[model samples]
Target: MIQKGSTLPEADFSQLKNGEMTNPKTNDLFGGKRVLLFAVPGAFTPTCSHAHLPGYVALADKIKAKGIDSIVCLAVNDAFVMDAWGKAHNADAIEMIGDGSAEFTKAIGLDMDTSVFGGIRSLRYAMIVNDCRVEMLNIEDPGRFEVSDAETMLKAL
Candidate 1:
C-alpha cells in the first residue's frame, strides 16, 4: 500500500464536469496542491453512500479551510455513476473522481478483490496529499470504518 512521504503514481482519472467528461492526469489533480482525498469501495454502497461520502461532503468547507486546495471522493465506479452519486448527495464542493478500471487503486496497492460482491474495488481510506506527496494516510480495516472518516481526518488536521 502507499505510505506517508511517498509521491502518488502517475495515472489517469475521469470526472464529470459541466455535463461533460473530463480526463485528468494525476498531476492535474495533485501537483502543487494540498488535497484531501478519500476513497470508497464502490459508489452508492451502504456505508459509502450513507456515511463516508456524506461526511466529507458535510465537512468539505472546514477541511478546505485548513489549507486543502480541494477535496476529492474516489470510487471504482464509472464517471457517470460517480457524477450521479455526487449530485444525489448535493456534493457540489467535492470532486467526484472515477477510477473505472481500478487503475489508480491498483497503482497505489489499495485494490482488493471481493469476488462475487464487486470484483475489484478500492479499500476505504483517506489521505492528505501535498504537491503529489502523501502527508498522512488513514486506511480502514476490512469491513470496518473508523480511522478514515471525515471527523477523524478533520481532527488530525
Candidate 2:
C-alpha cells in the first residue's frame, strides 16, 4: 500500500467521455492540485455501488469546498463499464477512471487477487494527493468498509 508523503506512481488511466475513450497520464491529472482518489475492486459491486461510490458522490460539493481540485473513482474495469456505472449512479461530480489492466493498482502495491471475481483487482482505498504526492491514505481491510469511506476522509481533511 502507498503511504503518506510518498510520491504517487505515474501511470495511464482510461476514461470515457461522450462515447470516446481518453487516456490520461496520472501526473497530468494530479499534478499541482489537491486530488481525492478512491479505488474499488470492481464496478457495480455491492459495497461499491451502495456505499463507497455513492458516499463520495453525496459529498462531492463539500469535498470540493475543502480545496480539492478533483474527485476520482477508480475500478479494475474497462472504460465502457465505468461509464455505464457512473451514468446509472448519477455520478457526474466524480471522474470514473478505468484501470482495465490493473497497472495502476500494481504500481501502487494495492493489487489483490480475486480470481473468483476475475483476476487481479485493486483493494478498497482512498487517498488525498497533493501535487502528485500522497498526503493521506486509507485502505480498508478485506470485505470491510471503514477507514476509506468518504465520511472518514472528510474528517481527515
Candidate 3:
C-alpha cells in the first residue's frame, strides 16, 4: 500500500466524456493539487452504492471547503460503467476515475484478487494527495468499511 509522503504512482485512468473514453495521465490529474481519492472494489456494488460513495457525495462540499481541489472516486471498471454508476448516484460533485486495467491499483500495491466479485479489483481505500504526493492514506480491511470512509477522512483533513 502507498504510504504518507510517497509520490503517487504514474498510471493512466479513463473518464467518459460525451460517450467517448479519454485517458488522463496521473500527473495531469493530480499535479499541484489537493486531491481526495477513494477507491472501491467495483462499480455499482452493494456497499459502494449504498454507503461509501454516497458518503463522499453527501460531504463533498464540506470536504472541498477544507481546501481540497478535487474528489475522485476510483473503481476497477471501464469508463462507461463508471460514468453510469456516477450518474445513477448523482455524483456530479465527484470525478469518477476508471482504472479499467488495474494498473494504478497494482502500482499502488492495493490490488486484490476477488475473482468471485469480478476478477482482480482494487481494495477499498482513500488518500489525501497534495501535488502528487500522498499526505494521508486509509486502507480498509477485507470486507470492512472503517478507516477509509468519508467521515474518517474528513476528520483527518
Report every candidate's CA lDDT: 0.95, 0.93, 0.93
Q: Cα RMSD (Å) per model?
A: 0.6, 0.8, 0.9
> Candidate 1: misplaced stretches above 4 Å?
none
**Poorest 10 consecutive residues by lDDT, candidate 3:** 114-123
The list of candidate 2 runs beyond 4 A from truth reads none
Winner on TM-score (1 vs 2): 1
Q: Candidate 2 on 29-120: residue-level lDDT in tens?
A: 89999999999999999999999999999999999999899999999999999999999899999999999999989999999999886799
lDDT digits (tens) for residues 64-119 of candidate 1:
89899999999998999999999999999999999999999999999999889989
For model 3, the superposed segments whose C-alpha errors exceed 4 Å read: none
lDDT of 3: 0.93
lDDT, candidate 3, residue 138?
91
Q: TM-score of model 2 relative to the true fold?
A: 0.97
Minimum summed lDDT over a 10-residue window in model 2 is located at: 1-10
TM-score of each: 0.98, 0.97, 0.97
